[model samples]
Target: MRKILIVGAGQSGLHLALGLRAHGYAVTLMSNRTPDEIRNGRVMSTQVMFHTALQHERDLGLGFWESQTPRLEGLGISVADPGHGRAVDWLGRLDHYAQSVDQRVKMAAWMETFAQRGGQLVIHGCAVSDIDYFADSYDLVLVAAGRGELVSMFGRDPARCAYGTPQRALAVAYVHGAEPRPEHPGVDAVRCNLVPGVGELFVIPALTVGGRADILFWEGVPGGPLDVFHGVTDPDDHLAVVLQLMEQFTPWEYARVLNVELTDPGGVLAGRFVPTVRRPVASLPGGGLALGVADVVVANDPVTGQGANSAAKCAAVYLEAILARGERPFDAEWMHATFEAYWEQARHVTKWTNTLLGPVPEHVERLFGAAGRLPQVADRIANGFDDPADFEDYFYDPERTDAYLARAAAASAWPGVRGARRIRGA
Candidate 1:
């Protein structure tokens, strides 16, 4: 078996480790914490995965929450104006549903799952200097950790990175007793309350530590009133801050969480990180190279909810690249090519995410406005979250948007073309 070392046990690391292990590679996964520690530790993220990424998990037999987790059938998008109160809102249906499995539960189970699959799961915190020494032993080393000393191994690719500062100061909490939406009634879709000029509030149904629950994800725009959760250590305090923010801005959501409480003491987290992309290969002191994987290379803000999905796709793409290079050296050249393959898919995600994090373009805003009136438009936008590849056709630019709308309008006028070919970017 060709020896492989995977650093960090996040979604990408575990997915790749298990996939490689099943393929008969001698894989050793380095994690900072054991299963119990992870399960009881602070919540890492609100991973509300859409279908494309979810299918990847099921293919790997890692969809343990499929039965218990709530099925998000669509996206309930409401653009609330700060001056005008409630504006246009719609529940756009998705062809395939999405699901959110709390990382606390998911990561913990995966660590144990990787171990049971004959992969070595080492519970030790790692640093760059440590990896420099370990890279000599393994045939290939892959770093997938989201943050910490391990993350610093990869240098920023200035040409690809867009933002120099954090776009949003995020505050997230998992809780129970969040009432159903009065509009749709039931956890059928991820309700995203878009407060224009402020930020976003995502109420996602999830399988958490305390069974089925909702994750109230608050993305506060810089210097906004919604960015008030910093320094709140107590879970109760965190919950209170969230409630107050909702009551002040998104009152409709506040009504649903009237009786909501923390899922566990370890369920609330508040922090900020700028979205970044870095060089995939890190040069070690001894002239060896460690390949950066997932967030370590391409980290995006959660505004678009593409973090988890992109990470899952990265692992699968890399696995394909590795298998194709059969009996060949996993050299720096191979690492760069492998990342380029993943980047082909991930670039769409990063573009969509970065576009969303900044000021909304008029053409894109026109799509959002039209989605409320047109079911086809709504469904396409809803499903686009699942597969961002579709975005290259219409979601990114003004000319494409105009072309898509023009084509749809002309088709509607004649009733001759029910389906028109997508407009490719010029």
Candidate 2:
């Protein structure tokens, strides 16, 4: 059996480790913490897995919380006007539902599952020297941890990296008792409230350790009014700051979360990271080559909510590449080609996500304005989260955006036809 050692047990690392184990490979998975530690630790991220990404987990039999998690059937956007009201608003139904499982709950369960399946689980933080010592023991070494000393092994690729600094000051609070949006009563949706020039607030229906809950996430433009959660360490203080910002910038959203409380002491997270893309193959001092996976290679801002999805897709792509290699050595050349294959899909995600981090283009704003009047247009945008590659067709270019909107308008103008056009609310 091919021996593989995976360091870091995040979504990509754990997914790939379990996948290789299922294939009868000798896989040793390393994590910084055990199942209990992870379960009781701080919340990791705000993830909403759409159809394709969720299907990957289902295929692996890792969708343990599927039934318990909230089924987000729609994604709605509310653009806050300068006057503290929404200038543009609409909800777009997704053909396939999306779901968010709190990383604390999901990762802890997955770690236990991997061990119960008879895979070796080592609880240790890996450094450059540690990996160098173990490089010769395994047929392949993959680094999935995107932090600490291991990341410095991979050099940054300046050409592909868009920004040298963090794009948004991010803060998250997972709370219970958030009421449903009045506009979409009884319908569960991911509400994205965009406060122009200041930042955005995303209300996501999620499943946490303490049952069903909502994530009040703020993405504040640096040095802006919304960037006020820097020193707030206490959970209650964090939620307080989050609510204050919401009331000031997005009062409509504040109405729903007035009575919300933290899910747990560790339910709040605040941090920022530079969106970067690094060289796929990292060179060690002993001339051993280690392959960087997922966020270690292509880390994009979470503005478009693609971090977890992209990591899942990267794990899937790398698994296929490993299976296809047969008896061939997992050398540097293979590593580069594997990441390139994944990048073909991931580049679209990176491009779409990075585009949203900057100022909204006029053409894209035009598209958003049109979505309120056209159901087909809104649906297309909503479903694009499932596969961001679809955006390359009509998202970036002005001509393509105009052409797509015109087509949608003409299709909605069919005369004397019942249900030919569904004009959703604005």
Candidate 3:
């Protein structure tokens, strides 16, 4: 049996570990925290998995909280108009529903599942030297940890990296008592509020440890007014800061969060990370190579909310590569090939995400406005979250954007499907 050591038990690591186990390979999963520690810890991320990623989880029988999590049936984008509330607002129904289960609840449950399935679970804080020492003991060592000393083992690929600094100052708070969008009434949707030149506010429906909740996340442009969550430690203070920002920049969203309270004292996360793409194969001190997976290799800003989705896809890709290799040595060449296969899909995500982090392009901005008038346009954009490759067709180029819009407009003219003009005009 091939023995594999997977360091870092996030979405990718754990998924790959359990996957290899199901194939009868010997797998050892290493995590810095225990199940209880993770479950009882501060909220990790704002994740809403689209159909493809969620299907991958269900394929592995890892969708334990599927029924409990809110079914996000659609996605709405509201571009804030200075002091005037929303300038362009519309909701696009997704072809398939998306769902978000708090990482604290999901990861903890996954860790326990891996152990219960007989995979070796090691609770240890790993470092470069530690991976070097254990490199010879396993047939493969995959680094899924996107932070700490392990990430440094993989050098940064300057050509692949777009930004040298953090793009957005991120702050997330999970809370309850938030009302649904008045426009969409009983429909649950992910609300994305774009404040030109400032940042964005994303309200995601999720299931946390405390039950059904909402994640009010802010992606603030650095040095901007929204970039003020630096030293707020108290949960109430954190919640207060979040609300104040909402009240100021996105008052419409604030109306929905009026009586919201933290799901738990540990339901807040505030931090920032430079979006990076590191070399896939990391050279260990002891002459063994560790392959980087997911965010470790292609970390993009969460502005597009692709972290967890990308991680799930990476794990699936790596599992396929590993299974195909059979008894072949998992060498540096194989590592690069595996990541490249994944990158073919991930590069689309990286490009789309990086594009959103900067100033919105004229054509793209025009596309957003069109989405409000054309339901087909809005639905295409909404479902693109499931397969971002669709964006490459018309997202960047002005000619292609215009062509696609014409096509969507023509399609909307078909009988029984006239596009809804949903934007609220000032």
Candidate 4:
């Protein structure tokens, strides 16, 4: 069996590690944190998985919280006016539910399971310089560091990278006692409120350390009001500021979290990251190469919530490619080809995410406007979160968008759909 070393216990790295081990490959999963450390640590991410990604976990027998995690049945959007309250709002009901399971619980459980399955679990902090040692020992090294020294090893592919600087200063907090949706009390949808030029606020329901909780994610534009967290350590202080920001910008969300308390004393994460796309193969000092997986290769902004989903798909694709190689040597060529295959699927995700990060164009704005009343158009956009590749057929550019609008119009026979078909979706 070929030895595969996976660094970082993130969605991609751990998924591939476990998949390889199940298929009888020698796999080593290394991470800096233990189950106890991670479970008790500060919140790592507001990771919500769409239909396909959730299905991948189910197929891998990692559906540990499928029954407990809150269902994100809809994607709600409220375009807030600076002083006039909500200018426009609508809910896009997802055909299938998306779910968010706190990484603390998820990753810790995964680590414990990998160890039980006889996979080597190494708890050690790694660095860029450590790539050489890993490459020399394992037949192939997969880096899914998410963020750390291992990330720098993958040279930025300028052709693919969209931004030169951090797009949004992100702040996330996990809290219990948030008010449920007024209309559907039992439903926990991903409720997003956009303050046009300012930033975005998302309230995602997740299963955290204390069971089910809500994640308030703030994507503050540079120099914007939401860009408030600086050297903030106290969770109470963070939550207080988060509440203040929401009250000032998105008051409706403020009402939802009126008396909500932080889930953990340390459950606050704040920072900024430049969304980057890197070359899949990283060259070592001694001419060795390590393959990059998921975020290490393509890091998307959390605005679209594609980070975890894309990473899960990357693991699935790489596992299949490796198995198909059979007895072939794990050469540089094989690595490049394998990454290219994954990129074909990933490109759509990258493109869609990039489009959302920017300001909405006129044509796309109209689509959202129409979605307020049209169920078909709304559902397509909602379910698009699952298979972003479909956006290429309609949501990416003018010609395709027009084509999709036509189909949607003809299928509905509603005069409203006909008017929408005239203009394209972005």
Which residue pairs collide, candidate 4? none
**lDDT, model 2, position 402:** 90
- Output the better candidate (2/4) by lDDT: 2
Candidate No. with top lDDT: 3
TM-score: the better of candidates 2 and 4 = 2
For each candidate in turn, the TM-score is: 0.95, 0.97, 0.97, 0.94
Better of 1 and 3 by lDDT: 3
Clashes of each: 0, 0, 0, 0
Looking at model 3, the pairs that clash are: none
Q: Candidate 2's error at 160, in angstroms?
A: 0.6
Assess candidate 4 and give its lDDT.
Answer: 0.84
lDDT string for model 2 (329-370, tens) is 999899999999999999999899899998999999999898
Tens digit per residue, CA lDDT, model 4, 1-426:
799888899889889988998899999888999988998888888888999998888888988998998888888877887693887687777878999999889998999999999999999998767768777888888888878777888889999988999999999988999876775676668887888889999989988889989999999898888888988888899989998998888887888888899998868999999999998898888778889999999988998888899999999999999999888878899999999999998888889988888887666766676667666777777777888876766776766666665567556665544234233341
**Ranked candidates (lDDT, high to low):** 3, 2, 1, 4
**Global fold similarity of model 2 (TM-score):** 0.97
True-structure RMSD, every candidate:
2.2, 2.6, 3.1, 3.0
- Estimate the lDDT of model 2: 0.90
Q: Which residues of candidate 4, in runs, are more than 4 Å off?
A: 398-410, 413-426
- Residue 209 in model 1: shift from native, Å? 1.2
Model 3 segments beyond 4 Å from truth? 416-426
Lowest summed lDDT across 10 adjacent residues in model 1 is found at 417-426
